[model samples]
Target: MHLHPQKSLYDLAQQHHLEGLTLPSLLALTKEQEGYSIDKAKRFLAFQGRINNEMLNHQVIIQNPYTAWFEQGDQNPAQIKAFIIQFSVFSNQFLIAQLHKMIHADTLESMHASKEILANEIGVRFQSGQQHENLNNQSSTEGSIDGSRFSFSAAHFEWLYIIAKKLGLSFAEIGQPKHGTHATLFFCNELIRLYGGDNYQISQAASYAVENWAAAGFWKQLIQGLQKYNDQTGLDLPLGFFIWHDKLEAQHAAHTQEELEELYFTQNLDEDAFIQNGNEMLAGVAAFWDGLEVQRQELATTH
Candidate 1:
């Protein structure tokens, strides 16, 4: 894949005659938003750091039932089954579905698109790989460094399936599917679809805030819990979803921050827009974690 020099988003919008496109922006900032002030940006980034940590602190995944279960080395099959249901649905499938959608938007019609238009889209997958090292042997056009390989989302599903099978729970019995929190995450999904072709807009809110902050923290606790669950239960189930993310998502998140910071320095990012959407993204995810807590509490009361 040929890498092109970066172009201003303003210029790309002008060139594509897409300035009049009516997609609702997450940032809701004035179009005349000026270059980012490093001092202000640093402060806001720090604020995001605090908010991210706080959201994790509030998650039920980090609370008593899970903590008590892990500490006591509980192996109640019913308890393990209930936890897996919430874990698979809200944490794994929901998050991966959103990512798959965003990745599709980024990679669609990519062959004819300019590097400037497709850079971030490809960068996301490249840093993570196509989930297939085999792609490295293919031609550039067929399997470019940042091009599609195996479906990352499919891998997540496989993880869910393996866990369900190990616990002797059919896919149907994980737990009652809850929509209250997922509905909020679905809103974030719509945002990815809304900004489908605009990698800059989609990534600003979706990748940075959602993937880097929300998913990162959620997964950290989740992976640990699953490991402990595995030890106590002796299920030895495949947990590639957790393992895969635990290893690579941090690298992806860091790369995203560096890329965004570079964009800020180049006056390509709108400060107000990023901050507004970043906050929204974080809140949406925080609610997602809250939903997991609700599911846990429901299990507690019923069990």
Candidate 2:
């Protein structure tokens, strides 16, 4: 599973291009000491807390200019398409790894949560108008996975493989991800294992951020780009990933919000701890996006 990381961002970008990515105008990358570092975890959390508080006061996720650019269809089409494919590659690489590790549970509440998570990971099917009905049938308190059918890892990879082909990428190319992609995967693993047999702590932290504070605008822009790509190319590409996530994540946010609220009142969840976990998770996600941005710029320079 450990493939060699690409040495040159530009070279990696080209590889991605061969896999069906579009190069866009390069943006200046402000050089920082590269590589993921968790040493600044505390400081990053404090900074994120300030930002979160500001958002709460203002009632907005604070629009990223990139989202606006994409939504307006002003950004380079090829670059946007590359991003969509790269993100899918990234998610496919590590998402289930984290989910599998999360299956180990100690407490009843955590066990229920884990089952619910695993069921989702397996992609339980539901008929149209039956999504909520099925979810409601799932235990609200015990968090059971009794009726949920588990999906094979191969089946999931097949989904990714098909999507990549539709987007002009081969399975082999999509599997070879940049360091940033691995960084995101590594962080998820670390978050789950960081608490030393107390997986629930870090899990709550990471989950709360992803399910609550992660930017909605970005996903909205991504969906718009994917739809446009399908339209322009006249291709029946697998856009179910982004399209489903656009809706599912919103519901996820709501569910996690309720979970947090319950924990805050009943479990005496520390604000600082909660914020720290959320921000640390966000930091990893930010690194993933930063990698994509740098690759975009590198690709542009070559073109």
Per-prediction TM-score: 0.55, 0.63
**Model 1 pairs in collision:** none
Q: Deviation in angstroms for 292 in model 2?
A: 1.5
TM-score of 1: 0.55
Model 2, global lDDT: 0.49
Tell me model 1's lDDT, rounded to 2 decimals: 0.48
**By TM-score, how accurate is candidate 2?**
0.63
lDDT tens digits, residues 174-194, model 2?
Answer: 544452355445544544453
Q: What's the CA error at residue 139 for candidate 1, in Å?
A: 19
Instruction: RMSD for all candidates, in order, please.
Output: 11.1, 18.5
Residue 282 lDDT in model 1? 54
Looking at candidate 1, the ten consecutive residues that score lowest on lDDT are: 21-30
Model 2 weakest 10-residue run by lDDT: 21-30
- Per-residue CA lDDT of model 1 for 74-163, tens digit only, reads 435655566566555554434434454445554454333333224322222333333343312211122233454444333444556667
